[model samples]
Target: MDQVKTYRTNVRIGNWNEDLRLEEDAKNEYLEKKQRGELAAQKVEVLKQNMLRPVDLTASSDGRLHFGDVVMLVNMGGENRARSTVSINADINSLNKTPSPAIQAPCGISAGQCVDACTRTAFIITSIDGSPEGSTLHFEQSFALRTTSGFAMGLYLSSDLQSFQKCSKKSRLQEVNLDDKCSFLTWWKILHFDPQERLEYEGQPVPANEDVVIIHCKTNHALAALGDQVLWTTYGKEYEVTAHTFLDSHKAEKDTNHWMLCTAENRLELLNQSQSTADNQEPTEANPGI
Candidate 1:
């Protein structure tokens, strides 16, 4: 009789365990559904915010790349500066070259369209001025007399341009690894390109052709480049710029000249972009003050 009682007790415990397992599984499923619903709601909110308020990419700031601000490109090779306006387009390749003067005209091109009329080379914005007619983006270089289109004729986003407000100021900046996912508002030091020796990190090979890394800082700081001098101001304190170079196996070199402080707003912009990608959602506009 004792043996039979022991058997019955074992059976009861087994049944209890099974019921508990089912309860736990149901709880997990409910939690997952709730999370998914919250995510969907967040995405809707983002879309709504963007639809209600569009961003202007030409507002003026003290040498920082702000939304709606027009930038001029100076092709140092030819000593010619061309004018172009900044738009809300995320694709930076949209800007095209115009006629020989390469000045900003009222005409606009769609994203990915090439401006076939001017010479292309890496240029810097020499002067930034704005007006209602349209902001003037001036470059520093003049084109050759040839009518041929230059391979470099496009509005290339400066790799040095950072979101400034996204990264943490206390973190040490270093070269980004292939598998590394860069967090928002973190500073990273990049090595400029060099043709001689290839760059390696942690015994793994890194490509030398691309910009070292994207860094985020605060927007309240000032960023300026004069000749070789790159300057950044934080809390009203200014810092001098320095040059760093790196090389990779592909016979390409990467170079970096200076640092800039990215603002909190910029950091949010980057975070939104990153979150959109990770979650397969789209970015919506937010209030500038937000």
Candidate 2:
């Protein structure tokens, strides 16, 4: 059996002859409040429905690790501001927590001040097979650079994930200033990598591939690159492009008939590369294309 939450509102409608402005305004506000309350209730209901994912785990006093136990750890305030790690029995979860930068106090600082100067964050899973005193596993977290003005952070890697060390001397991190008023970066992806593949490349000194592209919402300002070369970029949209993906043809080699699917301004569009003569090349619009 399941319990259902109910939301209710009360309102009184006066006669047409009685033109009371304050009464009408109060009625409208009450209606708006009811609508918002219903929406919030729905969101909470969704979260409650998905409760199979446990929020936390605890270990027993006697140091023994079970076969099928799950452990989740969270690190606070890294360069990315937050990171989470989940270990399941013998194998580690695919998600990798980003590492925090080393904290160093300036010279001439007192010992107490030096300790206060370090506000770093990190999480280490000492052992997955058994207790911390026995297992011999090591985990390496990734790195990201965050800026102060905006919520966007740089992934900073070589042009090619395969040959990333070639141009490693330059600054990999930089600010992404868009033309449109974007609130923040929503979602991003590298066209060629899958979840497991992404995890495999995490331990490498240089990333496995660098065909990087950032897709933003509120504006269709998507920037794509192949190796170190910038292939395309667009900006100035009233709504953020919340989601995007490259169409998969499921073949070996690159597929020529592929197109990118972008969602923005409450619409789905099939965006194709257009060889325009304009200063900034235009992406061909396939309207109402599912």
Candidate 3:
């Protein structure tokens, strides 16, 4: 039996008026050349949905998973144009299941061109001691950040998976309301959003705590945070964070845990953080420290 196969590609046709604004004969020649390219491209299928452009992927506490972004093309110097999170069933092979749209943030640009183009760089799940339902999945959009921009923007998928809300109250696409001193990446690290380990809170295996992200940006500054609270910020021109790893030091030590960060210069810097939640010295009726 002879088999029929289809090949696919993605391309942007050049603007006729702009590219052919020369003499009539030159314009005609240019169009003829472009037409040949277009005809050749039609021989193969042009994949329209960018399912491989996701910057991050994470599973929920219940084992349901989601991935970020569906771009048309990720070109050079392109910013994140991802806009939604497509939720997947726990059993990936389940038949006839459609991707449920859970998180959506319209960029408010050209309609239908890129309806959901907000780029998401990272995703993390956090269950603070006092948060609603004890946990929520966070999606980060870092493409909108600048060197000195205020606020990293993101969307929050509620624990129940029923709604999506903006993490920043001033939820504009171009600029979100985040801390002035932090970019989206720094805050992402500060939140300890990745390399999640299975943890036991009240005697069950769940994703919890580990909310300390150390961000070493291009500015040669290292910043650490414990769930949004800045622990320390230090500057060293020679230090540019290249990677982070968990060092299992002080296995018997409960108060402080150690982590290692690799720098551009190939030096490892160890960071220690206290996990103890008790403070007896500054006990007050209305305020308790953790």
Best by TM-score: 1
lDDT of 2 by residue, 1-290 (tens): 78775644544455643667768987998788667543444433422332112222323223322222222211111221111111111001111113422111110000010001011101112222233442321113211111111111111111122124322122232212211121233222222233335455443322211222232322322222112211111111111111222234552212111112111210111011111223254455853323
- Candidate 1 structure quality by residue, lDDT tens digits, 90-126: 1112222234222121111111111111122112222
Candidate 2, after superposition: displacement of residue 215 in Å?
23
Higher-ranked by lDDT: 1 or 2: 1
State in Å the error of residue 174, model 2.
Answer: 18
Clashing pairs in 2: 161-208, 161-209, 161-210, 162-208, 217-240, 217-241, 218-239, 218-240, 218-241, 219-240
Candidate 2 ranges with C-alpha deviation above 4 Å: 1-67, 75-290
Return the top candidate by lDDT.
1
TM-score versus the correct structure, for each prediction: 0.19, 0.18, 0.19
Error of 1 at 154 (Å): 22
Q: Model 3: per-residue lDDT, tens digit, 1-290?
A: 88766543544356856664667778788688567533323312111111112332222344321122111111111122211111111111111112331222221111011112223222232222233432333322112121110111243211111113532112211112122232333332222323242131222222222222322232212221112111111110111111222233432211111121111111101111111222224767777544
In model 3, how large is the Cα lDDT of residue 37?
Answer: 38
Task: Report lDDT (Cα) of residue 121, candidate 2.
Answer: 9
